[model samples]
Target: MNIQGHAALVTGGGSGLGEATARELARLGAKVAVLDLNLENAQRVAADIGGVAVQCNVSDPDSMQAAIQQAAAAHGPARILMQIAGIGTAKRVVGKDGNAAPLDDFARVININLIGTYNAARLFAAACAKLEPMEDGERGVMVFTASVAAYDGQVGQQAYSASKAGVVGMTLPMARDLAQHGIRVCTIAPGLFMTPLMRTLPEPVQQSLAASIPFPSRLGKPEEFAQLATHIVTNTHLNGETIRLDGALRMAPR
Candidate 1:
């Protein structure tokens, strides 16, 4: 699918990977909608990219419905959807808190990461399906973000791992389902990247995490992730697969 003049929606567009992707898409002639939980930050990124900003709670169906409608209003319909709105979990499923880690929290991670991805994908596909097919009979494509933890989650990542795993599980099925409509789906499992999620760590701690990588031995730049995402959007052959963005380093259990 050509990104030029396409309507693109990027969840978690406020910072990190999503923001970088949005910027890249905008630079490539796509009109982007920056959707995030943080209204101010979303607005800032949208302003910077000359796109619309939408405040969306991806975990909530109602919120996503309204936001998707708004995106349609602002930029026609989003034929390119990037699912990056997700939360990180550090608590165990059963913790030392006597009671097990709250089930709601665990469910929430699934809701935001997995269900949220579904919400955006469904909405984007529905809108795209209404449009005429492109040169290759491609209606649209969606790119989702997962984590390496889905495969090798450390001790405290039970909830996070489970949720991201669900994302991985869905990629192939989703692509098959959307095939008739000429839509495609793919997932990206990123390794240690310098995203806003990890920015909370101390600078030294951040360095340590980067140093742990094997070959490149450094954290991934957000722009690097964006570059891959851009390639996926532009390439019609890539679909129904999960690509790892980690730099040849497997994670050690924490």
Candidate 2:
């Protein structure tokens, strides 16, 4: 469906891939709502893209419902919902200190990464479903972010990998359920991208991660992920698939 003049909502729009997607959608003339837990960064991106800023905790049903309502009031119901808000925590189930990771810590990762994505997707898609389908017989599309670790998890990534894997596992069935309404569902399992989380590492660490990539021997760019998202939005045939944007780099055991 043509997204021009349509409303779009991107969670985690404050930084990294989410921010890039929001900017790209706005560039395409879509009114974007930058929903994020970080209000400061959300407002920054929102103002920069001439979009709305919504402070949201995606795991909370109330937060997501209220955010969608406010965004719709301002820009109309979101026809495109990008579930990019996530947290990556690295901790072994059994640490070197011989202490097991707290259950709360593990649950926190699941709450933000997996459950959060579902929360926002449900809210956004429900709203879109109520609206009329587009000229191309499409009501909306949802793009979720997962990590390559979801498939091949490295050491110290039990929680993070499991959460992301959940996101991947849900894509097909979710798409099937939403298909009757002409809404598409898909996932992007990104490899060592140059997102804010990666940038936080030391330069030497960044280089080590870059060198780990098979071909280009570099980190992926946010815009590259944005490219995939844009194509998924416009191409109606592409659905119920998870595209890996890792430049041929299958993650190794850390």
Candidate 3:
């Protein structure tokens, strides 16, 4: 579907992949809404792109509804929904000391990453379902964010891995479920990307992580992620698949 003049909503748009996507969509002439937990960052990006910024908590239904309503009020119902809001907490299910991991930590990750994606996607689909179809009965598109850990989880990543794995697990079913509604669903499992979270680590650690990749030997850029997202939105045939953005890297068990 053509993105020009369409309403698009991007979660976690304050920074990283979501920020890059919002910029790209705006460049393509889409009316974009930047949603993030950090209102200041969201507002900054929104201002730069001439879009609306919504302070949103993807995990909370009411919060997401408010954010979506705010976006819709400004740009109309979002025909494109990009879910990038997620959190990672590193903790071993069984630590070296043999203590069991806290259940609340796992629940928190699941709530933010897995449930949050689902919550926003459902609302996006609901809103888009009401709109008239474009060509070939296509109404909308949804792109979700998953991590490489979902498939090859390392140590100290039980909660994070499980959360991402749920995202990966939902791709085909979601696509199938929404197919009747002329909505498409897909996922991107990014490898080591140089996101804001990654920037927090020491330079040496970052370099080590970069070197671990088989080729290109560097982290993926946020723009690269945005590029794929744009392609997914414009390309009509792509759906129900989880594409790995990793640079030929299969994460080793740490």
Task: Give the Å error, residue 202, model 2.
Answer: 1.4
CA shift of 77, model 3, Å: 1.2
Candidate 1, residues 1-254, lDDT tens digits: the string is: 88999999999999999999999999999999999999999999999999999999987878888888899899987889889989997886666866678878888888899888888788778878888999789989999999999999999898899889999999999999999999989999999998877889999999999998886899999999999998999989999999999998788999
Q: List, residue by residue over 1-254, the lDDT tens digit for candidate 2.
A: 77799899999999999999999999998999999999999999999999999999999999999999999999988899999999988888888899988999999999999999899888888888888977678899999999899989999899999999999999999999999988999999999889887888999999999998987899999998988998899898999999998989888898
TM-score per candidate, chains pooled = 0.96, 0.98, 0.98
In candidate 1, stretches whose alpha carbon ends up further than 4 angstroms from where it belongs are none
lDDT of 3 by residue, 59-153 (tens): 99999999999999999889999999999888887888999988999999999999999999998889899989889899999999999999999
Q: Candidate 2 vs. truth: CA RMSD?
A: 0.9
Say which prediction, candidate 1 or candidate 3, comes out ahead on TM-score.
3
Residue 114 error, candidate 1, Å: 0.9
Model 2: runs farther than 4 Å from truth?
none
C-alpha lDDT score of every prediction, in listed order: 0.90, 0.92, 0.95
